[model samples]
Target: MTLPASAPAIVVEGVRKSFKDTDVLRGVDFDVPRGSIFALLGSNGAGKTTLVRILSTLLAADGGKAAVEGFDVGAQPHKVREVISLTGQFAAVDEILTGRENLVLVARLRHLEHPQQAADQLLGRFGLTDAGARKVATYSGGMRRRLDIAMSLVGEPRVIFLDEPTTGLDPEARLEVWDIVRNLASQGTTVLLTTQYLDEAENLADRIAILHGVRIIANGTLAELKRLLPPATVEYVEKQPSLEDIFLTLVGHGESVKDRS
Candidate 1:
């Protein structure tokens, strides 16, 4: 599918940053198409968080430029902030406030007049309606993570920066969060997610970028990246037919038997 000629949702060009004597990003470059899920993958200390910080206008880059939703992150930080919301690795909700209250607070802070209504809507959307009245401190980790994500959506942002959103959740809870993210993208919200989970990227991202040693080492769609590696086939026998055989039977198959293992 072809994208429009309008500016990309995110554009980073030759961006560089460093702390003390350690360079975290060295002339990085990439673009995220509007209304698509872009995943940035890397190991710990690969500068994923630092790049997020710079794009979210929380930190300045030593050099180069980045624009989020058509607003220069450095020159027009306020404009960038207006169109984007961020959820860091850790949940940022206020523990003392009730889940509903926390959402209301963010809505009010964003100057929404009908904060209560907005908060209630988001609560329902995230399946937190029943727990809305409970204090965040009493909520489970999964609930807190959901609330953190909901808070980020309070202002109806067009671009969202999710920094390792599922860091500490269990498999089921992580899947719950992934469903929420998928719904967001379906509604045309541009998502720039940084994660260490390859499976997470494979499941949710429209395109993936792998960062190593403070630079992007690879970038492409899942199938495109997989094409870079050699193909392998597995053979097994079972009395009950295999799911792969059923799927291939239904979808039709090709005869590219590169290997049988």
Candidate 2:
């Protein structure tokens, strides 16, 4: 089926999934605008990953419809797979392979021309040029995550699913991944991010949807969600830098601190 250029990159309507007796998602619906970052915010066990799996064609939904790049995820899974990529909570990299090798492997699998060149370009694009030759086992968490994301981009997929992309990273590493995510959207890749971090959704999403009770409890831009709260009473207080702010500042500015990555 042909879709207009203005159609959303992803569409989920009444999508439902159940694990035996447990209902994970119930009548979930959302639209992800092309070239935008859409975050699925929820606590653990909220079925965020389940929803991603269905949308990415990794798992079949029990009911409802989902499409990626205008292809039905259930009916045209192969076509959906052609235009989408999935990166799970953990960094999926081969420990024995060098970062460059990993990227090259994915490029070759995608049948891209000059796999080596593709890998090198991605290494540089993701700031992994210096670590490209090192075994992934030797990579820091952030580097591994970067390489994982780079692999996902091998085919220039129109939609990318990132499930808890920063689950096990330090603050610095999280910031690194955040920048990469922002860059992805800037380059017109539709990103569906499933994260439990409120600040993460606030920091990255163009629109955020809160999933709870097997349903989407809230959906809107951050500003719109914030408006749901009672009007703020005017107050005066000295603003203090957050611990994250201080850590980033000091760690970035301090010359003698050991590398924590």
Candidate 3:
């Protein structure tokens, strides 16, 4: 079914899911606008992954409904799969294959008209052209994760679900992935990101939703969410740079003072 351009890229209404006896999601609701980033923020066991699974058609919702690109997830799973891509918590790359081979494999699986060209283009796009011939097993965590995300783009999916894409990456690598996500949104791809990092959501999401106790406790843009709390009272104090700030500053300029010594 052809949807109007104005339709949301993804929509979920009263979505509920459960295990044998425990409820993972209770009437979750949200919508992702086209060409924007929507972050689902939650701590562990908050049903973020379960929600992504249902939206990506990997699992079924116990009740309610979800539609991706206007195709019903439960009733039109094949259609939903056709327009979406999913990246999970860990890098999903084949260790035996070279970076280029991993991309080529995904392109071939997607049955692209020119898999080699597609793979090469994606390799360059993700800054992996130089490492394309190296075995994935030899790749760094960041490199492997970049390749994994590149593979997810083989078909130019309109909607991408990134479930904790930066979970295990180092700070620098996490920033790299953040740049890639920003680029994707800039290029008209709607991204649904589930992350436990508050900074991640604040930095990337056009709108953020907090999931707690199996329900959406809050949902709004960062500024709007901030409004939910009482305004801060003005105060003067000596400013201090955090350890992370000091670390990143040192790294940005090269070796730390200690390393030089």
Q: Which candidate is the best by TM-score?
A: 3
TM-score of each: 0.87, 0.89, 0.90
**For model 1, how does the per-residue alpha-carbon lDDT over 73-179 read when each residue is reduced to its tens digit?**
99999988999999999999999999999999999999998999999999999999999999999999889999999999988999999999999999988999999
Looking at model 1, residue 117 earns an lDDT score of 100
Q: Residue by residue across 61-105, what tens digits does model 3's lDDT show?
A: 999999999999999999999999999999999999999999999
Best by lDDT: 3
Candidates ranked, most accurate by TM-score first:
3, 2, 1
Model 1: how far is 197 from its true place, Å? 0.9
> lDDT for model 1, on a 0 to 1 scale?
0.86
RMSD of each: 6.9, 8.6, 8.1
lDDT of 1 at 142: 89
Candidate 2 lDDT by residue in tens digits, 27-58: 99999999999999877898999999899888
The true-versus-predicted C-alpha distance at residue 230 of model 1, in Å, is 2.6
Question: Candidate 2 regions off by >4 Å?
Answer: 235-261
* Native-referenced Cα lDDT, model 3: 0.87
